[model samples]
Target: MIESPGILYSIGAFLLVIGPLVFVHEMGHYLVARWFGTKVEKFSIGFGREIAGWTDKRGTRWKIGWMPLGGYVQFAGDLNAASQPDPNAGDASAEERAALFQFKPVGQRFLIILAGPMINFLFAIILFMGIFATYGQAQNAPVVSAIMEGSVADQAGFELGDEISAVDGRAIDRFDELADIVRLRPGQQMQFDILRDGRELSITAVTADVTVEDRFGNEARIGRLGVQSAVLEMETLGALQLPGAALTQTLSSLEMITVGLGQIISGRRSIEELGGPLRIAQFSGQTASLGLYAFLFFMAAISINLGFINLLPIPMLDGGHLVFYAAEAIRRRPIKPEAQEWAFRMGLAVLLSFMLMVTVIDLGSFGLWERLSGLIS
Candidate 1:
């Protein structure tokens, strides 16, 4: 669907964005396992046949696989890359058994499994902090500068110079936060609390759904309340203040995503907008074209999404592993191997089906089928 230079550009951008994130995630697991005295058998970046690799002094086979979609770290005593304990690990030499991942205390095992996602979150925080410290944040107070004539804001009696205090009971400090909330709930009623003339008043209005096209020609419908901010302000974070600002910004993004997901689940938004690798590649290339700051912000966002997705309680994922560990903790033993295998199979099936659906959506978005039809004619 993507042709020539565009295809090559997308591939390069995708690799650059995903490779470092995957490496950071696996490194978290590898480092924590080593800390718990477990031997890592392999540290891999990607899957399938090895393209290139070398052994470390610690005897771990570090390799890059042909498929660059995802990666894993295999621990000694694991049957495969999924970290299933080797059935014969029990019969291993006492010395070898000492370094077996399964032999570790449950707490240490839990920590090792958790370290991967935790590191992803930490990486996002660091990236955000660095960006904020370097470039600072561009912000604007949520003060109404103008009310669109005969629009929702005008109908709701929104006046110029009114500072927004809250939306739907959620306190908003900046104009962007107000925009974020309003954009997701098109045609829905919203309650706005504003401070005007030193008096606070609440106004209720229904948002207007506006269809917009992005630079990539993707169409999306978002809500607009028709009130503009009075003035834009650039707020610079001091070195000492960077951490707090970064954390706040990162958490806000996460919360916004969570709310967006909820809206989709509630049928307030279209699930057809769900995307897969193709969509991700498109975004990667587009962001890279916007220069370094934009690319770094995009990477931070992807890292946060990765961390959150990995924390979902689906088997074959980090969260699923955590669930098993939790069960083992309560029962004083691991779940039956047969049961674990079945859970993983189901999880794999669900993931694959979702991937296929999103891939189809991506192709449709790219007009791949339409182009092929035109060629046939």
Candidate 2:
């Protein structure tokens, strides 16, 4: 059973993960709208009550909210549900009512909508780079520490303390090469050349099948030869290595997101794997158990997920708004007010349903219901 996380760490983790992501996302809209001469009504992080706020020079209300789930930037003339439609929008008859969001040009609206997700992507990239700057890449060098008896190496008659000199007759300069060579070819026989006590010994070993479960609970059939390599020598980044590390980290995350999407579509993953708020809290607690660095790493991963998910072209999302903007640009007109309102309603329903479904999965995944069932039974 998973233990509950420390309250302070859990709260800190939530703030760390959500705050910057929302800030960047909202800032994207705020900056773009400003550039286009659009008046932003308010910039808010979270919902419900306001915690801290100030009217900016532009008269935009900058606020931190009590609820930390997500945020929004309300542009003037945003008389609709931000992206929804309202025929009565920005119509000032009797008193003071300047242009709200609806009055913005198609080009300006395009940039405003695009800004939110772009900022998220940029934030992820920066985080990845920051992580890399702190921890340099793993440098692989072959070092044999110990071998388990009755394992693959043992069955193959390979001796302990044998330095892997080559794999499949290929010369191995570094220890890391063995992992990919082994992992990619499951249930296949492989040749190994090891430096056993300074004597070259060649042997054949059959790779084993391993099941890998990712954070999303998607399992993969992987190849394993049951060989353990000594941990790579830790690295300390010099001045020149920081930028490279960050770039690599960001690219790696993007690749991972691609792989995840493909797997979901290919029937290799379950839709139940999608996680909502519950899972974030679960991960927060789990990471807190591993200490500060681990928690921060988890925070980075969640930030990336938030960024990517927001970019999906779903209605009620930043991406969805961008889609509408594109349509408006092509048609040279706003989507009809009624059409936009109906679209918002549809989008809202779909998003809410998805959230509810994922929350159920999250609760079950965490075993909270399981524990309760056991207690009841």
Candidate 3:
């Protein structure tokens, strides 16, 4: 029997992770719609034909789709409920068509658009805080662990066991904080305060220009001060520790998204850096192997990504609708329907193109074609 590509296994793994994550995202929109006195028509866990579902007393149909790409929420009084174009709209009566998104008041529409992303952010915070409150956070004491051969850290005369006290006079307590400052430049020189033996030590590390590939096959020559943390010394925290930890995680997530976007836009990174479902499964399986702690962390990161992607100001996206609503609020009138329609079309095209590109990368990353071609070759 031919090997299954571990396809089913990966799919199961991804569904375990993404199904709940996407539900949380869509629920953010759904709950908000209800809060605003709008009726929800459907709450789907996946898209396409409904394999399993039910209608609640509230008259909402909850179903799972055949294609498990992602989930969505459909508000009431709308044909198909999403931004997708519907040929069925042509046959609708004038009153039916009148209930279209474009006909909604700008203020009402703004809340609906804003809710999806807002819920994502809220979920991230809650997850982070929950994790912290339950298990606590462990951090290293800003000590250098390993120095990569020929890396910037090695060349900067950074010896192992040098306890980094600060970066640019900012007292550094965590390795993440140090990484944030270090990765900010590829060739920039920064001051480092270290505690060596018992005395304070002052040093400078010139970030070397080096290229690294991200999760997606994007190349970036970044300032490489290649250093590893000594170890994760377990430091348990009290219940009050959750909020702070949540804030820290939030800032870190924001920094990552900002840096990734900047690198992609600046040509320092390539578009091939994007990965879709397949990649998630690969990582998810790996994370599952590492056990619960790592899996939770991975899920949290993915949650942050979901939030960030939704917040981007693109048509058909939560952010895109918010932009239009903002414009309407300022001008005291809705945007021309044609403009909204055109923007939605363009956004859909861009999103699909990106999805296809990511799928390609996923296939390559998994070496599907390469292995097959090698057999033929």
Candidate 4:
């Protein structure tokens, strides 16, 4: 049986991981709004009723909410956390009207909305920079040290010493890159460029689709290459190289997220693979148990995901707001309030439904469904 972290530890780790991320994300919006001379009414670390809070000198209420799922920043002249323009926004006095976010120029408003996700990405890069500056980067050559017997690689005529040079025309410099490419293309046929005994050759193989369960009982489906690296190496980077390296790592992570999302949308991957707060908590606990470095790495990856997800063009997201601003910039006027309100309502419903679906998936990952079935039977 796989051992799991205690409930208390998981909850604590979850908060440690999430609290700062949410703060950073919301702070992005707050700072940008303030820079544009807009008033930020509230900065919250989560949704729902306030657990503890204090009003700042600027009259912004800083608070922690009971629900730890997500957070928002409420600005002046906004209907709520979604930042919808207030119907009474035009009724404000001159002094208050000047500070209202709704009255800001389209360019300023776009930046204010864009800042949140941009900051998340920046935060992830910073975390990665720290990690590289301290522990360096872990990597291995793309040489096939071993291939599983009768597996896809083996059937594709992969030799033990064959070195992978590329995958489908994309250059592969490291084992991790090759692994990442294969992992995202489960059950799909891929062309591989390899060097076998100093001779260049190409091989085609279909990656095996496999379901893997972590110690915490959370499951994920990934493509398996059935090959191993002979040696793992850590390359230390100088201070000057750290930033670039970190940015590359962040972009690589962002690419993986986008690919996974595309697969889900295209029906190539299962919606059951989507995770919610429960899975995040479990992952937090598991990574924390591994060590500080492990936890930080996990945090950075999740931060990237948070940034990317918010940039989706779906309503109620940062991307959706940007879309509105884009239209305003072109048309030389704001979209109709009635139309905006309807879009927001639709967006809220989509978001709520998504949350519910992921929550159900999270519960199933914990064997809730199996236990319930057994009980019923």
Write down the lDDT of every candidate, Cα atoms only: 0.88, 0.72, 0.76, 0.91
Q: Is candidate 2 or candidate 4 better by TM-score?
A: 4
Q: For residues 23-116, could you state the per-residue lDDT of candidate 2 as single tens digits?
A: 8888988888777777777889998789999997879898988989899888665653355644566455433333455666777777778878
Winner on lDDT (1 vs 3)? 1
For all predicted structures, in order, the TM-scores are 0.94, 0.74, 0.82, 0.95
Writing each residue's lDDT as its tens digit, candidate 3 over 216-304 gives 34344566688998666666666677777787788788777887779778876666666798788877766665567767778888888
lDDT, candidate 4, 1-377, per-residue tens: 36778989999999999989988988899899999999999899988999999999999999989998889999999998899999988999999899999999999999999999999999999999999888878678899899899889988899888999999999978898898889888999999999988899999889999988766565678899899997778877888999988998998899888888889999999888788999899988999998888999999998988888899887799999999999999999999999999999999999999989999999997889999999999
State model 4's lDDT: 0.91
The superposed Cα distance between candidate 3 and the true structure at residue 185, in angstroms, equals: 6.2
**Ordering by TM-score:** 4, 1, 3, 2
Q: Against the true structure, what is every candidate's RMSD?
A: 2.4, 6.2, 4.8, 1.6
Q: Tell me how many clashing residue pairs each candidate has.
A: 0, 7, 2, 0
Minimal lDDT window, size 10, model 1: 1-10
lDDT of 3 at 216: 32
Best by lDDT: 4
